[model samples]
Structures are given as structure tokens and as C-alpha cells.
Target chain A: MVEQGGGASGAGCMGCPLRQRSEWCVLNEEETRFLSRHLKKRRYRAGETIFSAGEPSHGVYCVASGTAAIRKGNAEGNTVLLRLAYPGDTLGYRGLLLGENRRYGAEALGPSKVCFVDRAVVKLLLERNPALGQQFLRRIARDMDEAHDHLVRNATLSNRDKFIHLLRALMNRHGRTATDGGHFMELPLSRRDLASMIGARHETLSRIIGRLEEDGIARFSGRTVYVARSHWLLNDSRPPTLLD
Target chain B: MVEQGGGASGAGCMGCPLRQRSEWCVLNEEETRFLSRHLKKRRYRAGETIFSAGEPSHGVYCVASGTAAIRKGNAEGNTVLLRLAYPGDTLGYRGLLLGENRRYGAEALGPSKVCFVDRAVVKLLLERNPALGQQFLRRIARDMDEAHDHLVRNATLSNRDKFIHLLRALMNRHGRTATDGGHFMELPLSRRDLASMIGARHETLSRIIGRLEEDGIARFSGRTVYVARSHWLLNDSRPPTLLD
Candidate 1:
């Protein structure tokens, strides 16, 4: 069933991982209590949209578990995968605080649980707590920095370099080093998602992956991937010039 | 002589155009007074850098007059013009508030006057006034949105379309409608600066502008450009299909 978004109670927010982690969501005692009162948990299945573009923002959603993709469409109507949202990351705060409609859509990659807090409480907390406002500002600034970097990369990097960059980013986030020292991981996104991320077509992505496998740089079986040449993928001193 | 940046008196913040206009800068009476005490004016000549990438941000710069370009470099070390900061726009707040090094450099596009407010006082004002915090948040959100839009344009639009889009943006911001109903504007930036904004080489930009002039879509005599065929450039219904 596609849970189309509504108030669905899942768990308490008193000791939620996002709240407990100072590095992730820092909420003081009073602010935490205030947010806890308005917290409502919601779940989504694989390929479900947590929110859509142009929709009114109710509040921020804190992801508790599972992965999701932030997607936006270009002027030519081509979809681009902006970034992936992981556990402990908050979403929708940008639109909510700015009082603007959603510019991008958030879609779940797998079974995901997210806690939503109302905008009213958020505004109140921001007004009352200067530290929390600063945290929000920092988070937004980091996001802006990442977006700017992506713009630069999209313009400068070749499709092959971009794929390697994306793979390395995913590996850093979700890879588990095997006994043989090769990093292995199951891709959370499909080929189409990966292509959108690298600003390439799905067929192009398939061709690139096939070439990488043939060259012994990467190995993929279904959604599972192993970077045989992790060093090459992450080589910063001198990158291999792979022509597209 | 290059102004390496120092305290220079230009204008008072009290009753300044930015502060007097609610839509521009939203500071309350008390907050404005507090900011006025610490406000130092600085003026920059054309091609002067107000701030640089990787530099320590001392405070926020509120543009009092004239326009400036915000620039950043890509991974390949190519300079990209990120944005144009106009009068009433605030720069360096992102770095100051986040306590991070400047990600992009700000350079005056023409003779520009800017008011600098110390970060310590800005923080104090933010804490004391919730509206000021909200205003900053909105400004940052808008910047993020514009950056995202630029990313999408870079990925999808053809070079010709991108140039037209750039022209349209400039015309909207700084153009004056002439007697013949055509938008007339002085190009604040040189071909090099314009090229960087659209991720194109300076030679390519020159060629495109030359073609536009030859085709009667635009006329450029040195720094002065007259867009005679503004309709052609601003046509949303159908875009010229130019092969890259």
C-alpha cells in the first residue's frame, strides 16, 4: 500500500536517534519537549514519494530509518536526483521555514519511517531558541554549499568521472569492507536514479558500468556492487582519464 | 590601485535605502540602531574583489549601491560566476553565521558601495530579534533555490539557450525600457565575466554575442548592448534549437 501521507503514529520522540545525536538534530530540553508534542510518525514503502514538488509544507520530517532520494526536475522536464537523505537527516524545513512550496520531491528508496513536526512549533522554537536557529542556518548553509558543488561538478566532470564520484560517495556512506578488503555494498538506488544523479541516460549508465566491469574496476551482480579498484575510484592525486 | 579591503566611510546605515525599504532589509528600529553603531562603509572599484574564496569572513556585507559578482571555481580550476549581488542584497552572512570559510568570492561588477556589519553584532541582533533571523533564513533559501535552478539549467539547456536565459535575467534585473519599447542596459560585466556565469569559455561567449548581433537579435557596441529582438530572446513558447 502506498501511504499517501497523513498523521500516523509510529513511535515516541523522547529518545529518538535524530534528537539524541548532537551532530544530527540538536534540540534542547524545552525545544525537544515542544517538538515531541507535535511529532507524528509516518511510514512509506519502496518507491513512495514522501512529498511532491509545489506541495505545501506542513513541517520538517526527520528520517529515522531507510534511505530516500531528493529529486528535482529541470526546465526541460528531465528529472535529476539531487541527493540522498539518510537516517537522522531532516527534510522540508527549507520550504516550511521559508513559507514556500516544495521545490523538490522526496521519494523513498525503500521501506522508511519518518517523524514530522508542525511548522508552528518549529517557528516558535526558532524564535525562542537562538541556538536552534543557528543550527538550522548552518544546516541550510551546508546544503547550499553541496548544491553549488554539484553545479560545478555537473559542468566540469565527464560522465565517467561523475559516475565514479557518485559511486565513491555511495561507498563512503554505505560500503562495508569485505574480508578480501574490497568494498561491497548493495546500491540503494536503481540504475535510472544513478543516471539521473550523474546527468546521464539510463542506457549510458549501463554502458559505463559494463565498461568499468570489463576493465576490472568494478563488479556488479544485480543491485550488489563491489569496487575491485577502490584505489582507482578514489584516486585524488591522478585520476584515470576515461573517455565517454 | 586595488582596494585590498579596509574600513572606509561611504554612507550611514540610518535612513539608507536598504534599511528604509522593508522589502529589502527588515531590521526593527532598535535592531537598526544597534547595527548603525557598528556599520562601516566600504567602496570598491570595478573588478575589485570584496571577498575571496577560503578567506575568513569578518562580517556581513550589505550592498548599499552598485552591483557585484559572486564567483566560484570548479574542480577543474575553471572560474564560474555564481551570481550577481545587487543593491540591498546581503553577502558573507552565510560564511559568518555558519562559522565557515568563504566558499565563493565577491567582486564588484562596477563601482559599488557596501556597508559592513560585524558578525558579533549580527549574532546579537539575530538573538534579540526573531524577524531578522527569519529574514536571513528567507534570503538563504532564495539563494539556494537560484543555485539549484542554475544547476538544472547547466545540465539541460543548450549554450545558446543559456546565453539567452542569462540575457533575460540581466534585462529583468537592470534593463531600462527604451523609447522604442526595447530593453536597453549597460553591460555591467565584460565578456569574460559573462562567460564564467554561464559556464562557457570567453571565446565562445564572444562568438555567441557576435552571432546574436549579426542576426539582429541583439546589438553590442563595446560595453553598450541593445536587445532589439527582446521578444526572440524572451520567447517562452518556443526556443531556438541551436546545436552545441
Candidate 2:
């Protein structure tokens, strides 16, 4: 369920942490002021639906904190995890711009904060600011490029290579250095969710994890994964071969 | 090899068929005239590289006729066909927008004609025309949506179902109705290219095609696929099961 937070009056976009991110659009003073006046903050608990498939989007959301999963269900009644949204990422703008219903559902992967801006305001801002529109184009283009990469990986990579790639991504996004010169991070998603992200069966994912443990490359305790050799995880071009 | 064609002097954006496409951007007379002044046409033979991966894009390409394959090489050195660009589709805008090297290579799937516009001209037109920029945003958004759909299908669909989905797509794009109420089309891609597009091994794809022929669902004759039941191919939610 959406927990309605205070409007932009409490904490506005003027000094938001997202502005520090390179991907965030640069807004002129007048545009920023106008945007701040129209923004509303919303919070969601883990597993809460931020938006659903087929829903009409009247506004776009900015991920102010935490992560969200973008997913869709296929004809077979199985859900596929398309990608994860991180801080500073905008959602629903695609549907809004295309004037179509949402193509996928977005859910809070954990406790997350998102800021919403209405359709009219977003349109007005883009019309008045070419820089913002160009920035959006660049961001969407980068997204398309990543999507192409994901398609290639899905088509060509072995399951073990795919898992390693996913781990490398997770470490880059969320892992931290530990006292043992390793990388440590609480898994942002459940093992089941991870399985869906990597396009592996639950049993296959479990077997891969077991093999990783036996190889002493990574250790998983509860929902946390510890990479003993962080550099190897990050830089190794050749993934360790698995007997599975 | 790129065969340089006559400049925009021969024929221009004015009355160009691409302008009729709903996906193409709406341009004012001034904008169209400005664009035409800068466009240069290039022709490519089948299997010719339109643009190589890692090349810096100084501008964008507009597909005037025929088809092109967008592809990228994976870590294992196998090329993955990312997607196909048909007539009226714009290419390289993503790389141009990000000011980055091309993330993938594009090649002519058949004899094709393409129009090129330089970066400065494109930037000038976009700056002077907000409608053009907005239309690009919409197009990129649609592309992103399709990419997400591709990701989901790759994850969940069985190989047979995937082949059926591909056939349905091809039928929609290039199929012709036969007198007997069937759909027939020359395959835009060779069997090897189709295998790469669908992420199947060459042998696996051959087996699938053989099965498709035996089931009386689709018939492959050299470089063409004829579907006896066009409506079934398009609307059948339940894919025929195959004994692999």
C-alpha cells in the first residue's frame, strides 16, 4: 500500500540528494521552483505495489531512496523481473509520453521513497526547457542500450556467467568493503527474486549458489552474500567453470 | 560496403513516405525543409556493414527502404542480433544523444537505402522545434517498452512459443495474404540469422523448423515461411506443444 508522505513543501527538489547523481536532469531555478511546488512524496513498504500493469499513468515517479523492481506477467501466468530501478531513476514517463497504459508493474523491493510529478506539470516543464527534454532522451537512450545488452546476455551467456554478472552488478550498486578485504552486502532481493532476474529456475539457482559456496568464491548467509575476493568478482573476465 | 547515393537534391524529406508513419516525428514545413537540406542517402548491399560497433556516431540514420540488423558481440565472441530496423525507423540517435561510441553494429539484412543527417543539423532542428524533440522522446519510450517486452519473452517463453511469436511478428510486418487465406512472406533473414535472433543454436533452430513443418502450422521453403492458418498464427494463445 502507498503511504502518503508530506508534499514537496517539507523537503523540496532544491537540495535533494538525487541532484548529485550524474543522470539527474538539470533544472533551472524557475523550473525547479515550479516542479517543487507540484511534487508529492509517497512511501511504500517492501513488496508494496507502486504501480500495476495496465494502470493509466497520470504522473511520473522519481526514486528518491531504496530500490524498486519493474516486472511483468506473461501469458503463461509467470512473472518476469525486467530490471531494477535505483535512486534518481524516473518511472512511468514512458507510459505517460506514449499515452498508453502501463506495460509493466513496479513494486518496492524494500522500504522506498518516491516523488511524483503530474502529467501537466511534466509536459509544461519539458515544453519550456529543452535541456530537460534532451537529458531525458539521453537517459532513455542509455536505457535502450542496456536493454540491448541484457538481451545479448540472455541469449548468449551460460547460466553461471549470468549469475556472476548479476553478482558483479549487485556489488557495484550495493556492496561495501568488509574488514576481511571482501565485499559484503545484504541481498537486495530474495533468492527467488534473484532467480527470476537471472532467468534461472529456483533449483538451478540453488545449485549455482551451492557450487559457489563449495568453490569458496562467495558465501551466502541468510539474505547476505559475501565475496571473499572482491577484485576477482569485479574484474575476472573468465567465470569459473561449474560441473553442473 | 556503403554505396554513396545522390544527395538530398535527388529526393527529399518533403513527401517522403516515412513522414506518413505514425511513429515518425511530426515536423513543421520549416523543420522539414531544414532537415532535407542536410540529408545524404547511402545504399548498402545485402550483408554490408552499415555501421560497425565502437564507431563514433556523428549523426543518425533513417531507414528509407529494406531491413537492417542491429547486432552486438558478446564476451564469447558470438554476435547477437539485437533487433531489426525496418523502413521508416530511425537509427543511431541513441549513440548520438549520449555522445558515446556505438554500442552495437548495424548491417544491411538485404539491399537497403538509408538517409543520414549530421549532428549539428539535427541539434539545430531539435533546438528550434519542440514538437520534434517530444516526438523523439515518445519514439524512444516506445522502443524502451518493446525492449522490456523482449526481455520478458526471452525469460518465460518456451522455444516453440518463441518461434511462434517471432512468426506472428514477421507476419504483421511483412506478410502477404495468399488466395487460399494463408500468409506468405520471404524471410528477411537467413536461417542462421533467425537462429541468432531467437537465441537458439543452429541445430536447435533447424529442428524447430522441421517440427513446425511437420505440424502443418508453418512451412519453410528455402527463404520463405508460409502459415496455412494465418489467424491461428496471429491469435492462438496456446502454442502447440513440441516433443524435443
Which candidate has the highest TM-score of all?
Answer: 2
| Candidate 2 lDDT by residue in tens digits, A206-232 | 999887787777899988989876444
Q: Which candidate ranks first by DockQ, i.e. highest?
A: 2
Q: Which runs in model 1 stand beyond 4 Å of their true positions?
A: A1-11, A22-25, A29-34, A229-244, B1-11, B21-24, B210-216, B230-244
Query: Worst ten-residue run, lDDT, model 1 chain B?
Result: B1-10
C-alpha positional error of residue B28 in candidate 2 after TM-score superposition, expressed in Å: 3.0
Clashing pairs in model 1? none
Q: State the iRMSD of every prediction, in order shown.
A: 1.7, 1.1
Task: Tell me the TM-score of each prediction against the true structure.
Answer: 0.87, 0.91
lDDT of 2 by residue, B147-196 (tens): 88888888877677777788788878888988898889988877777787
Whole-model Cα lDDT of every candidate shown, in order: 0.76, 0.79
